[model samples]
Structure formats: structure tokens, C-alpha cells
Target: MKLNLNKKYANHTFHIDSYDSTSIQLHNLASLTLLLELTPRAEQLRRIIIDKVPPTFRATLPKLIGTKGKPILRRLNIVQQRAVLKAIAANEFFLIKGMPGTGIVL
Candidate 1:
């Protein structure tokens, strides 16, 4: 899948598009940039995953769009946010634990 992100953090309207973005660098960057960039491909991604884009990367929504990040952010209710946070925490544990062992209690 093709994805593009505009770097609003940069003084200029920096943009990049790639299918070659399969590397960890791209994945991590995209994970980081989800909230800050224009992310024109957002609607396309929503079809595949809810909150597919992380909030950390959204560009401050221009005044026109409302307080950056707060505007276009997927309107996740409190319960949803807590569930997502829990999932992310679990994923972090999985990554840090590396290969699970028999010691795993669950």
C-alpha cells in the first residue's frame, strides 16, 4: 500500500511517499508521525484498521481545522481509548519479552 505524510513540523511543507517504506524506520516514523502529518491516505487506512494512525504524529491542525490533532482525530470515546492503551501496553510487553517462554503465566 502507498502512504504519504506531510511534515508540518518542518518549516516547509515537507512531503514523502513510498511503497518502499516497509522498513522498521518507515514503520516507526509513520507510527510517530500519524498525528502531525496531513496523511492524505488516512481514509484509505481507516478501512483496514481503526486508529491505524497513532496520535503522536499528527501535525497541529491548522486553526482552520481546529486545535491540531484534536480536530481530525478519530472520535474515540473514553472506553475505546483505554482499550487501545491497554493493547499498546500489552504489545510493549510482548516486544520487550522477545520470544515467550514456558515461564509465561498466561
Candidate 2:
């Protein structure tokens, strides 16, 4: 029997050709495939993330706020300001999560 899938599933048409009932399938099977593909790359990134930042660099990051000026910082609340600072200071990656109207971008 043919099934009508959503347009979002269009990009994953290859899965239909490769379907196998013996294997376990999750609700978003492509996510599992993506995770598998990303596992090795994540391991590589983990090594870089684990590397220590030099003491001098870490010390200078706080001073940057003063030298760069505070016009932007003055507009944000305490939490948003801290998030922006952390994002700036991050060596590899920084993530901020907030409600839709919380303005994580600024």
C-alpha cells in the first residue's frame, strides 16, 4: 500500500527505497541516521572542546567588556547580558535557550 507523506519527509525519500522491517525504526528515523553520522564528528569536536583555554586569554575576556564599550550591554537584562558575554567568550560553541519572546539573539 502507498502512503502519502508530508512535504517535510520529501527530502528523506531515500529511506523508502532502503526500508527494512527487521530493523528498529523511531518516529523520526532520519534523526537516528543523522545522530549516527554525527557521532564521529562529535568525538572530534569533543577533543577540541576539552582543550584548556590559556590563562592569559581567560583573564583578558572579562576586560573586553570594558574596552568594547557597554552600549549594547546596557540594553539587555542581567541574564541576557550574561548569555551574550558567554557567547562571546566561548572558544568553540555556546548555546542559549529561552522562551520565544525572550530575545536570545541579542
Candidate 3:
């Protein structure tokens, strides 16, 4: 079987040479080893994962007018509205944990 790693290594083709229940061997071990080395993309990802980069607070919640010209947020419950506001105000990352059917999106 042939395998493609990513867009950066799309030109290189890797073949499966051997396989077992535990592991699979590629025909070109050198190519696979190259993937272990860190690239610029990997470095940026590491920084973001470690929170070394500054938070991005560019997004804002949109104001949707209802049929009666009332703001859509006014219709949401206080807790839901607060959650949405918190998510919009997040700079780096925001995580919302709730049970099923809690009306929380992402």
C-alpha cells in the first residue's frame, strides 16, 4: 500500500514494506525519519499548544434582529447568553462543558 504524509511531502510516496499486529514498516525508513524532525509549522503549533503566543480576540458576536426588531441574544436564557459572550470574548481558547441538550455549540 502507498501512503501520503501531508501537503509538504506530497511529492514523496511511501510504500508499506511489512506489517504485523504490532507495527508496520515502510519501505523508505529515511523518509519516515524526516517526519520526526521539527519544521516551522510544528514549531508554531507547539507555541500555540503551550500558550506562548498571544491570544487572538478578533471575533465578536453578531447582533441579529428578530421579526419584532428585538436583539436575538435577548431571547436566549441568561446562562446561555453568558456562555456565548464568554466564548466570543475568549482570546486564546475557550472550552464549554455541559450535558447533552444544553444548547451549547462548540
lDDT of each: 0.43, 0.59, 0.59
- Backbone clashes per model, in order? 10, 0, 0
- Stretches > 4 Å off in candidate 2: 1-59, 99-106
lDDT of 2 at 13: 48
Candidate 3 per-residue lDDT over residues 1-106, each given as its tens digit? 8664687687887766645533334544654555445987555556665556754554554554223324756777777776667666776566667773285644
lDDT of 1 at 90: 49
lDDT of 1 by residue, 1-106 (tens): 8443445444666346545447866887776576345665555355335554443323232364334534333576654443433434442122122242222222
25-96 in candidate 2: lDDT tens per residue? Answer: 553475445544658765545454445432221434767686674888888788788777766776656655
**The CA-based lDDT of model 1 is what?**
0.43
